[model samples]
Target: MRIGVLGTGGMAAALGGAWARAGHEVFVGGRDGAAAEALARRIGGAGHGTPARAAEYGEVALLAVPAGAAPALAEEHAAALAGRTVVDCTNPLAPGPDGVMLTTRAGESVAGRIQAAAPGAHVVKAFNLVHASVWDLPAGAFGETPPAVPFCADDAHAAERVAGLITAMGWSPMPAGGLDRAVYVEATAAFVIGVWWAGGSPRLAFPEPAHPSA
Candidate 1:
């Protein structure tokens, strides 16, 4: 698979590196040319260029920029991103007095905003729940079985393709209905982040369920 990553940040570096290691052709691009090039080299990506060019080069474009910057970047590359499967890995979280808060309009999610910015692109919301550093770990960052990655998107084909990619990366893919449900996922991130910051183990609440013998 050919993937284009838009950013020079941690998410871009980690996920892009993982994809490259999985034998995907990756191209990285960012506002900072040197940083983008450096990241591309580190990931052994096929190429590096401006964000617009990277969008054009991908069958699946990964928007790994900051959440606040995601919509603008998508809008700026709308033309190049048309009809492409664009994966949004941004979390619209802002620091609050106590913990993190999801920063969105009354009912909008960051993924929805990015989709609106590039109306022609199939934007899927994913990778927002885990920290970027987790991608640096082996296939299953947790213990034995890999944690499921929940995603939402309106385009079924595009969503399935992205889900397949996630499976290839050794994580379970959980389809979380259509695009509208993405807000819930984003909100969960805010809550989980708060728990993590508060020194609580959120994962404890989601223990492995016992299964009946077949």
Candidate 2:
């Protein structure tokens, strides 16, 4: 599989490196050409270049940029992404008066906005539930069974392809639902981040024995 990474941040480095290590052809692209080239070298990626060029180079385009920038970038590469698999790993969380909040408009998710911007792309929401450091480790390090990576997508072929890529990391790919379920997943990430910011483990509420995959 060929993957085009669209950022130079932690998520891009971590997941892109994992994919490259899994024998997928990876191309990195960013606003900063030097940084993109550096990351490409560090991750064993096949090449590096402008985001639009990278978008055109791969079967799958991994949108690892900041949530606020995702839609515009998708719009910029809409033509390249047409009929291709687009994997969205962004979480639109921001600080609010009360606490952490999902930054997207009510009833709309980050993935939905990306889908709207690149109408022809098969968008899938994933890799937002956990921190990038979690992906930095080997999948088997967690436990006997690899952790399940839950995701949502509107297109079946896109979902299956993305699920196969997720499984290549040795993790279980749990399909949550269609694109409509993305809002829930994003909200959960926001809540989970808020608890972590407050110095609490969101996982503490649900014991492993009862909620193994939570």
Candidate closest to the true structure, highest TM-score: 2
Q: Tens digits of per-residue lDDT for model 1 on 100-171?
A: 898897679989998999999999998888888988877865778888889998998899889988887889
Off by over 4 Å in 2: 208-214
Q: Write model 2 residue lDDT over 13-90, tens digit each, in one string.
A: 999998998889999989999999999999973699999887988789999999999999999999999999999999
Given candidate 1, what's the lDDT at residue 123? 94
| Sliding window of 10 residues with minimal summed lDDT for model 1 | 205-214
Cα lDDT for residue 88, model 2? 94
Query: What residue pairs are clashing in model 2?
Result: none
Q: Could you tell me every candidate's TM-score relative to the true structure?
A: 0.94, 0.95
Please list all clashing residue pairs in model 1, or write none if there are none: none
